[model samples]
Target: MVNCKNCGTNITSKFCPDCGQPAALKRIDAHYITHEIEHVLHFERGIFYTIKELITAPGQNVKNYISDNRSRLVKPIIFIIVTSLLYSLVAHFFHTEEKYIKSVDARTIENQFVITSKIFQWLQNHYGYANIIMGLFIAFWAKLFFRKYNYNFFEILILLCFIMGMSMLMYGFFAIIEGMTHTNLLMYATALNFLY
Candidate 1:
């Protein structure tokens, strides 16, 4: 057996048993850089499959994850982070909240609308934190409603994280559409998302 280049330990496999590093670290050359970038951008597994499973069979996905098939699905915390980042990026690039505010009739605002706008702005600015807090509430509510499911708090939290992460993307786009069209599309989206 040869010593692992990474940790100088006897390793018979391609990876170091102790640290999980490759036994033979590749040189930092053009080929290695190209391969690494390609693997991250093209071959890496995430997002698409996560969203697909969340959409197609959320309950099954949750069950599978809790029942020892965890490796097949993305981790709930990572999914939440990724989806939150996506939501922030889309909201910033498109200015959906600003558009929505502008689309509102001035007459409708009258006198008290300034405070309402301020509240909306605060909510938008702290959306990531708000989402996490909301997920906690959602998990509690689901646990209460689905008592027969017999899931504990943390387990239900994981399920809600995956469920909310998937639906958040839809809410982002629906807001964009509502802003662009100056329509009441958000009302319908809100109803749909509530049931989601």
Candidate 2:
């Protein structure tokens, strides 16, 4: 048996049980750089499959995720982040953000808003602390109500995050549709989010 390069652990199987590294290591070369770049771009199986699985059959994905079939699906937090980034990018580059900012009446606010960071302004001058606190409440209630399921607050929080992420993706898709049609479909999007 060879020692694991990662942690010097003894290996009996193809992978080290302790560090989970493979028994063999490839030599560094131009191929290594090419492989690294490919990994970064996920030329192999990656985010596209995750997004497709989530979008097409969220119920099965969530069920599988909760049941520990996570290899195929992206992490809930990662899904949230990617969708949020996509929405932000679309808003930024497509002048949607400018439209929203211009629409907001600065005169209506009586010196309450402080210009601190670009992100703050981009989020419509809202820190969204209320939403976080409310999410905690929802998690707590979910844990209490679903006692038979035996999910802890953290687990419920993850589940809620997954649901929210899915909704965010839907909103992003709706925004794109609205943008293409040059119509105010986001009014419907807002209602959909509220209902979701």
Candidate 3:
């Protein structure tokens, strides 16, 4: 038996029972690189699986994630950030501008609060971070309304992350359609997102 390098625990199997480190770390070769890539993009329990579960049975999947088994679903925060980044990339590729924002005098807004304007601009550019901030507000209200339930604030936030991540994918799909058709479908997409 060899001692686990991670936690110095003696192991008799392929994985350490204490820290779950592999008995023998694989050398950094072509096979190792390919395996690492597959591990990250694994369809079984990775992002694709999470998306499929969320689309099929979101409520039950999230409940299981919070209560029964955590490994089946992707971590909530990573799921949201990945999906949000995907949406942002698709939107950028489609050259989709925020048509909802009307032209305002930049000088007037910048003069009032330069920091506030800068913050807004940053949020506009970074969809992942902006979505997390929005999820916090959503989670707050959800927790307040569902105070009778056993789920805590963080659990509710996790739910929101899964939900918002799916919504971002929906937005990305719509953006592709809009780009192909050369038609403004933002309103429809927003309405569908609200319905979701």
lDDT of 2 at 61: 73
lDDT of each: 0.72, 0.65, 0.85
lDDT per residue as tens, model 2, 27-131: 999999997655433623355666676667867777778876766666666655665666666665554644434433444675444443334465543213323
Model 3, TM vs. native: 0.85
Model 3 C-alpha lDDT versus the unseen true structure? 0.85
Worst 10 residues of 3 by lDDT: 97-106
Residue pairs whose backbone atoms clash in candidate 2: none
lDDT of 1: 0.72
Off by over 4 Å in 2: 11-17, 23-45, 98-108, 113-138, 144-149, 194-196
Compare candidates 1 and 2 on lDDT and give the better one.
1
TM-score to native of every candidate shown: 0.67, 0.66, 0.85
Evaluated with TM-score, which candidate comes out highest? 3
lDDT of 1 at 93: 73
Q: Which one is best on lDDT? A: 3
Per-residue lDDT of candidate 3, residues 1-196 (tens digit)? 8999999999999999988999998789999899876765699998999989988888899999999999998888988998988888888888764642223435987577666667767766887888899999998999999899998999999999998999889989888898889998888989987877
What are the RMSD figures for all models against the true structure? 5.3, 4.9, 2.5
